[model samples]
Target: MTGWWCASRVPKWARAPIPRWRNWWPRGGSQGVRSSQDYVRKAGAAARMMLVNAAAARWKVPATECTVERGVITHGPSRRRLRYGEVAAEAARLQPPQDIPLRDPKDWKIAGKSMHRLDIPDKVMGRPVFGVDVALPGMLHASIAQCPVFGGKLKSVDASVAEKMRGVKKVVREGDFVAVVADSWWRADQALQKLRIEWDAGANGNVSSETIAAMLRDGLADPKLPQARKVGPNIPRPTSTTPPWSRRPARPG
Candidate 1:
């Protein structure tokens, strides 16, 4: 006699449901759903903006000339069709938003469904053209130096050795900041490395975190501090007995 045995292959995770039948909600739960709703509500707006911006990367289309409808993008007159995904790819390479009149809602299509963002690939690939990513011919690198203390005045700076450094273009000193300009960041940094700046430090120089805490505590301790609220006509007027500076003087006498 032969005995029959059944064999089955089971997944390692099949032994139990995740959370052991706790009926846990999916990740992103309510908040995720809300955020997603917000994203959808704004999707058309984002697409409307991106369509024209992306169009310029390829051809001249006014922002009002292009729109996203049903995941496809249409440019004005030509009715040329593109996927939002495609537009997003093109837009990731484009400059920051410049006004192109946007298509109004009455003229829209493709904006309502939950679809993935068009710029995802560029962001994932680290190829997004952000402000810091812009490159122009003859562009120079710049870094700012400022007084470490508030309201400090720059005394003087010695740039003799710094001026001699290779690749140093110019040292620009504005009221509160000094910019070391050069052909390249490394060179600018090198140029600044040789300079020394002095400033007239202000009152906060000797102030520490501990002293600030004490001051805050003392301010809070003064009951008058709360009554001194600057907002609205409800502010309590100072009485004659109050400090001279706190009360308006009676007359010139």
Candidate 2:
């Protein structure tokens, strides 16, 4: 049987056919899909036109004056031109999504090109702010301490000494885990290091990866094993692929 198409092979321009939602705003806003395709078509056209117009206006030139060439933008007499990067901030502020108009098909230059990311330079220079880099005044450090056993319960916790420790403000024990909030990450980590957790070992306490694998092997050996797949109305025998454990057999053949 043939395999499914890879996601990358799918055409981006060819959109999934879905029911268009109706625009109820024309006669006092309500809700529902549009009965006709005309409105949707007009809106799409208008948006494209607005973008081009907005770009031109932002650069302080007429719609016909500036042209988006390649990824860069150019304006003024043919010999003298500037990259879109130079004026993107101003152009973006001017567009404001709702206020700007898209360009007509004939007026487009940059949009037609295969688009690429605009923030590559910022990322390479490590100037972008990610979640991990976020900093706030008076913010405290926090870390999680998970239960040792997969399904175990925490009987109780004694944090009398931990609370008195330097930089440690409080110890929070909730559900099956505990967290120590402190002035700094080093202090929180140190406090957590000193914690003595009392766990009631459940079913998974002694269950290691090897033990689970043995159980799975026994299950696979059963003739009554449920069929995960039936290809072409026939049961395909499992192939013998060399597993790392199988290499060191007790009695080598």
lDDT (CA) for every model shown? 0.59, 0.57
Against the true structure, candidate 2 has what lDDT? 0.57
Query: Per-residue lDDT for 1-253 in model 1, tens only?
Result: 0001111122232233233226643444456445333333343344346555676446575656665445566676887877655666676565434343444657444334465566688889998777666779999987667888777767778888877888889988766567689888888888787778877677767776667667666665577866553335665543322222445765422
Query: Which predicted model would earn the best lDDT?
Result: 1
The parts of candidate 1 lying over 4 Å away from their true place are 1-114, 223-253
lDDT of 2 by residue, 1-253 (tens): 0011111122222122334347322422443223323333344333333444556665556767655444344565553354444554554454324443445657544334564666788999998887656779998886658788778877677777777889998898977788889988789878887787787667788887778778767666676755633233477546333334544645312
Report residue 70 deviation for candidate 1 (angstroms): 3.4
Judge candidate 1 at residue 119 and give its lDDT. Answer: 69
Model 2: what TM-score?
Answer: 0.49
Candidate 1 accuracy as lDDT: 0.59
Name the candidate that leads on TM-score: 2
